[model samples]
Target: MKLSKYLGYIFLLLATLAACKKDNGNYDYKELPDFYIDTVGVQKTFETPQSIGTVVITPKVVYNGSESNLEYLWRVYGTTADTLSREKEFRSVIANNPGTYTAELQVKEKTTGIRALMRYTIIVNSPRPYGWLVAYETQAGGSTDVALIRSTEIVKTITTDVVMRNIYSEVNGGPLAGTPVSIVSNVSSPAADMLFTSQTAVRLNRPDYKKLQDFNQLFVAGAPTPKPEAVMEVPFFGNHLINDGEVYWQYSGLFIGKISVDTKGYKAAPFGYAIYGKNGGFYDMLNRRFIYMEQQLSQAATYASPKAGSTARFNLGNIGKDLVYVGIGFGQNGVSSNPDTYKYAFFEDIDKSKRWFYGINFTLPDQPDLCMVDISAMPNIFNAKYFELGTLGSVAFYANDQILYNFTYNNATNTASTPSVAFTAPAGEVITSIKLLKQPGSGYTGTESKSNRIMYVATWNAATKNGKVYLLDANPTSGSLMATPLKVYDGFGKIKEMCLKPA
Candidate 1:
């Protein structure tokens, strides 16, 4: 009986151990919490201050187990420091300047001390405001250089060389075909609009000035035709012309590749004498013809020619177009509310007997005929070499080697006042170019207003071998318009061209 009771106790102990082990081995099925972000494999943009990303938890479970206490954090960094930090899913950021940035997101299970993290990259950009650009040609090698001019104050100044020595390599990786004529910026597209250079008419990008392409390759497409000798932007019209030493091919704008106007090719001056009007109409000197541009590439069917049996009413019987001098005489008021709606033209015909035409209505069909003015009233009419029309339609100034003449026009009666000497150059000097500096309206953002009229005259003294630019008041009361120069800019070999850019 004692032996049986010992075995029974041992059996009881063994049964209790087996029951405990089987109970622990078969536990109920339950899953732990997991996390993931939905923003993976996607790109985003932030133009303004807004949430850059929203972190989401995947297979989200109710607060229980170790995940009962959780934490979320987001951070952003720039080059120098941590820019932003947040404790929630929606992480927001703002960058006023342009650059690259980094962002990070982290989530942690506080009880278990386990964490999950993610990283991202971002980019920011700022808008480019307004500025001006100037072009200079050195007399040493006739090399053209461009300067960017910016002004925080009232005075304008050159800030940097926008296009350095890279202009040569930008165009076909070859040498410049000719002297640089001009540099023009497309206002419509500040970033993509190509910077136009006269040297080979190569278009360059705005930021790095990388070569985009040339007009020759884009237009001709590897054809056998000779590339343009030079490309120049016409003042006020924003139109560009390609000269092949014979004819001038013009385009509506650089954006459009179509050839807007193709004149009859002929040998003449380097750039032929063509007076372009506000409307796409031009007077050709060589052919003695007038081509009116109704729109882009619209010069094919109808044109004004002096040849017999033409549709145009006006005819040049024996006069030649080359021996003529043209200038915008005045802008007059029309019947409409807009001021200065009517434009009058002035041209001097250099025939056997020199004659001046003033107050001529070149745009009106009824008054298309040219009438000679009795400029004999002016004593120095015989020596006027270059001329400039004043903004005030009735007045104009003419210049010779030594003196400038001021002539007044009477639009009502179609006559002119007696010409008087307005300015006298120094001994052995002559005026090379005379430009009336009106406020540059097209793309200039400078302090110089149209109200503050100014005149820039470039003079060359052959004997002294020096070139000087004289700044004068357009309208003065003391004696003459250019009685004394307000300022003089020297040290230039020759002031070939002067263009105004805004700052």
Candidate 2:
């Protein structure tokens, strides 16, 4: 009886021990403490900047314990690799370079020794506000050289034979072949941010002002091309086509396009008109005569209805082939449905001291026209001297040796007012070039209506052999057309031409 009672007690004790073990195993499992970065992975992308721009990274931190015990660290790599910062709130990180970058934030709890990491993607871009590219010319020992003005106002010369060098310039493609007749920008798209120069017809990237490719690279099927006298882009029928003199190169993004002959001209208007000086008159390339372009994107050139005032035929002789001086601006009235309403292109004859204005009209497709208006009758007008169109439409400023005249156009009456004296440069100082800086960056914005419009006049003192640049207040509405200069920059070498690249 005693042995049986002992066995029962042992069984009861063993069963009790098994139940306790099961209870302990169930109680041992506890929920994990939640701590993570609250930001979703989708929020990891960042835009790159052109310069050393600041990037603020504020990641949401989800912690279960005391926040003071947590340490934060941010690391950035790729374009500019480095430890960005250590503060819990990431801010003021400098993204100074252009490229892809990877950023990681490490959050560590001191007491618990718990660490969490979050990664992000960064993309840096060198877009607009890319700074100014100043195009200027220098002459020494009978050699005219071209130079680029950096956004820092630092003069950089590409020509090796020149006396000075543009020490700060970043253009590494090579020097320009000859004197630049004009620098034209590709305005239709920023993806193809490019500029074309008249001399050698070289194409340059806007980002670094470097040569985009070889001159022949722009040709179709790698065919040989003649040295382009001028290159331009014309937007019509919702598409852009490239024109370099007589040849036509269509733009299909970056490395693809069709090359063929469509029009013949050294200059073209933005509104699809090819202008060439031939037989003592303006030859319209599209119409194969002195006429306007009627069809859009069609190889067959057509003429507009022959209105008395709307014919491309002109008797002007040997017009300036340098489209660099051509000015396209708006009329006093807004963009007219006439297509010719506010559109005017001013040109000067190479053989004579005469100015001809070509008025564009597209009211009637059948009546598409380029009307020639003679502006040579204006008094004291400089025939072939430095003439510049102001940012504001209908106003043109001319420089004749030492005099500056303003020629205002009246869109309401379709007439150009008589030329008035705007300013007389200092005595004994010859005006080299007249340029109006309307915007902050390179390329024309066509809206230089800022009251602070400054007319940069490059002057050379023959007596001193010194060059000076005068910044005159160019507010025509200010009543004083010949007001004193707001600032004069002296001490640089002789400046023959001035072009502004925005800063």
Candidate 3:
């Protein structure tokens, strides 16, 4: 009986196998369409400026399939991936920031569900890459705007100058919220432009001038009071921000990171100077002294008591006067000289009756004081509104109302030249801002003649409610302004501050 059951099971398996072999399949098969993109004449890379009209790119797509079944797409990859077009040709204005980007083109066949892709390198340049960044307040002090005196040449002669007004508003869609105070460009690694106002502060990306971070995002701990004073940057060293008389700093690096407050418990003056290979210098308003801080450290310390019996002109730790202006001074020999070692600090007494100029070799270890002289006898020293150190020579420029005066100081003799009129504005206009067009990096040698030999003077007229910016050629040795300006840009708001933005 077991043998018979086994035979029956084998017979059943044989019958099932025979039935499956007799059946045949019934399905249809079709070949996929062949398609390719012809890149023979297609541009593989594109270089354009921001808002330079339209950037058109036409590609030749070869396909053996139906043209109606083909779909096209274009995209650019930056900080964020953005779709540019859906047509076969890319015809649109690429107003991306001044940086490198990757663009992609995708062609798809709907019927075959197949796609082909090609990538391209895109470099967007800034139209106003190098210029004079002017921050100004609108009429009635309602808000603030920024302008750029666009330059055509990067090095050599400045062929042309065009004033682009409302730059911050043109890019940001509105004005900065508050009265303008200062505008500074950090021409170091991870370059940025810091704009300060009474109510807020903003950091803008360089070249493109796009907003990167605001006050809250700039600080690691949190935003401080909105009394923004100044933002200072020492190329390749560090950056410092003065807010509410407090100092916050960040070391120079690949990224613009958050800054931490200096915990030394000192009130820093609004303006300070920094040397490339040495510690940064700042005036301690509360202690009435000078303090120095290393680039990598947060705590600032006073310079060691000028050796015990040293004939130091003035003690660095005990300069009991109000700091009016402090800056690195360039000698008459231009930037080739050891200008980094020379520093100047101008001060005033408590009653503002007397002012003094202290020339020091900041790089020296001890007794850096070169000379100290009372500059009160100089013309317009008592009622000067704006002060600027000359980019070359031992000279200084100060403005009193509409009159701008220039005087040379002799560090060796502890004497100063008689103040001479550099430029006089119109009768009704008052000098608002004066700045030397000097950049901070050693790599700017190619453009030294243009950058280091120009001065900017901004004036405002109350009656006409007009503002004007004058670009004047500066005498390298005498630090005197040319009788006629190279160019004059009018039709602006009340100018508050101006700084050089180099390429």
How well is each residue in 208-316 modelled by candidate 2, as lDDT tens digits? 3445664456444553343333333333211233334343434443323333224443333222332221101123333223323222222333333354664334322
Could you tell me every candidate's TM-score relative to the true structure?
0.54, 0.54, 0.80
lDDT of 3: 0.76
For candidate 3, lDDT tens digit of each residue in 345-408? 7889978889998886666647877778998998878888788876557778888888898888
Candidate 3 Cα deviation (angstroms), residue 381: 1.2
Q: Cα lDDT of model 2 overall?
A: 0.50
Query: Which ten residues in a row are the worst by lDDT in model 2?
Result: 273-282
Model 2 RMSD vs true structure: 11.0
Deviation of model 3 at 321, angstroms:
1.4
Instruction: Please identify which of the two predictions, 2 or 3, would achieve the higher TM-score against the true structure.
Output: 3
Q: Can you rank all candidates by TM-score, best first?
A: 3, 1, 2
User: Superposing all C-alpha atoms, what RMSD in Å does each candidate have to the true structure?
Assistant: 13.0, 11.0, 6.2
lDDT, each prediction: 0.47, 0.50, 0.76
